[model samples]
Target: MSTFIDIHALQTLPPSNINRDDTGAPKTATFGGVPRQRVSSQAWKSSIRQDFSESLDSSQLGLRTKRVAEKVVKQIEQLSEGYDKEKALSEVAAAFKTVGISLAEPKKKKNEEEDSTLESGYLLLLSNQQINRLAQAIVEANGEKLKKADVAKILDTQHSADIALFGRMLADAPDFNVDASCQVAHALGVHESEPEFDYYTAVDDVVKEAEESGAGMIGTVEMMSSTLYRYANINLNGLVKNLDDSEAAVAVAVQFIKSFITAMPTGKQNSFANRTLPEAVVVSLRDDRPVSYVNAFETPVKESAEHGRRYEAAKALAAEAQELSETYGMEPVKSYVLAVGDLKTALEGLGEETNLKVLLESLSTDLSKVLAN
Candidate 1:
């Protein structure tokens, strides 16, 4: 039986282009024959990963970049004072070759300063522990070439929290792929939404009264305000297996819940400052399967005379979950809710209401017990 943790949030954002398309407009999708603002899963996942960097230890995180060899080279230099940049680059490149990852040849600039940094063909997601261990292996080798099996073994295990949660796919070496234990649904607005344009001009600060009569620059930016439905889930069994530690998996889950609720996409943040917390959050632990209440907004929530979109959306979500539970007997082993304002009243009976801190603490205890079983 696969244990799962499902997290749902109803958040409201002010006029902002949190995620944009090639045209620089806010992302949108048509659901129920109505256009609704959207924020891609990739965007939210990126925000969550960045949030991880702030709260989690650097050693328990991974780096995803094409400059894997360069990072390893730095690690090698740190591990052994005897190894210089040139020597470290050679050793790191040789170690990568053993794992079938050929680093790009160093390119020399016009200045004739040979760039020693080697890049991989694509971005490689490697945990900090893996980099440290690989560097230690090179230092221990003392100019001797590392074996293929040794390098592969070092890369295969010791996954960091982010890597384990989001997983990795190495195109050049599929054997090193880690299946992601978590899935995030692209957040969609709960009601029909249309893009609004902000047309404005900027004056040149250096321009004197007679120097420039017109504005230095003028442009239009597309923005949208929406109450969105967000959903994500984690396969606890898979997470535990990826981490190889039940307690650590629980800790990751707690952090993920917090991040999912609070982490906001920073697109045009300076322009809009559209950061907002979730109006309501519902978390459930299940032994059967994870359930998403996204269908609640399929009909598109409409604001009432006395209440706004956030309150209406919360009501709809609660009603949807209740209907599904009554009809299908889809009940979770444990559940919690954190809501504010009239949303607290609108989401009655969804679960036990709690604050963010208490919700995480209780979730940690419950998850440990569930995993123990």
Candidate 2:
């Protein structure tokens, strides 16, 4: 079943560039002298998903299987009234296995030692020999000769040697519910002032930095980058309750997430970033000679042509991405990629003597206020 969710819930206050210089003054920089907070798109995704259920993925028994197994067990118990529960269950499982349903003997947990008495909570525990005897009894009761192949198939698919299970859903497609759940409706703005930098991101080598820091900060722009681009994934399941069906799943999911977003002539674009251009530009700069980074509060750059090139390149990519999206498909993956290109280009061009500090101070502070809380 598909759930209809509003995309607005996904939006958030723009990220802030609230860090200070070594002297404890507010950080400053310029991209046309305007400061911009550099929040990555991913930080937003994680923070929001966090507000929801943590047990969402723990549906261990696969919903459909549990439901069907329940029905199957109840039906068999009545028929095998003369027999014990175990014997009755074995007989019915054989018949279902004879049909085309795919059933399986529940997998045993690796850590559990197999006892002759069987584990207390395991729903299915009949041994190979027991299953055969059960199957034989079932065939005799039905008054039909059962082909071994048919019996195996039915048992493997439908009569999952299982009883107690969880995570069953009434509806088939679970992903549609998740996709339809969230949307970032507002184009929030970022700001230049705050008590602290919402985050400090090291450029280029995120994994190295993560390893060095012991524990990485949560919901940082860099963290967003690391999650989607480097780790985790956004998957699309098919149109229906089809599982392990890649083609169907991809088509259903792609169409789903893409549909929630619409291009508009006049609508606000939300951003979680909040900083002045000079501040961001300063941080973007990678000075490898000393293997150290310049602070937004300490060094300013807007004069160097190299710095200009990097800023311009990043802008161009972002513009290109927007243009491409407007021109063609604004596939989420592609759009985000272009945005990242903008960020990487900007970061690479930072230099020691640039002069964007003034421009950042001058941009509309209202824009900054719009994104950050």
The number of the candidate with the highest lDDT is: 1
Candidate 1: residue 367 lDDT (0-100)? 90
RMSD to the hidden true structure, all candidates: 1.9, 19.7
lDDT, residue 193, candidate 1: 96
lDDT of 1: 0.92
* lDDT for each residue of candidate 1 in 1-373, tens digit (9 for 90 to 100): 8899999999899999999999999999999889999999999999999999999998889999988888888888777776788888888888888878878865666789666678988888999999999999998999999999999999988899988999999887888999999999999999999999999999987784668678889999999999999999999999999999999999999999999998999999999999899989999998888899999999999999999889999999999999999999989888899999989999998899999999999999999988898
Candidate 2, residues 1-373, lDDT tens digits: the string is 1212111101112222222245533333332344532333333333322321232232211222222433444444544555455544454544544543334444557997652221112223222322444444453566454566655443332211111111112132222121211123222122232233334444446756566543344332221110001111221111122233333233322322332221111111233333111122211111111111112212122324544433443343334334543665522311121122334554342222222333222212321232232
How many backbone overlaps does candidate 2 show? 61
Give the least accurate 10-residue stretch of model 1, judged by summed lDDT.
105-114
Model 2: residues with Cα > 4 Å off, grouped in runs: 1-61, 64-83, 99-321, 326-373
Total clashing pairs in model 1: 0
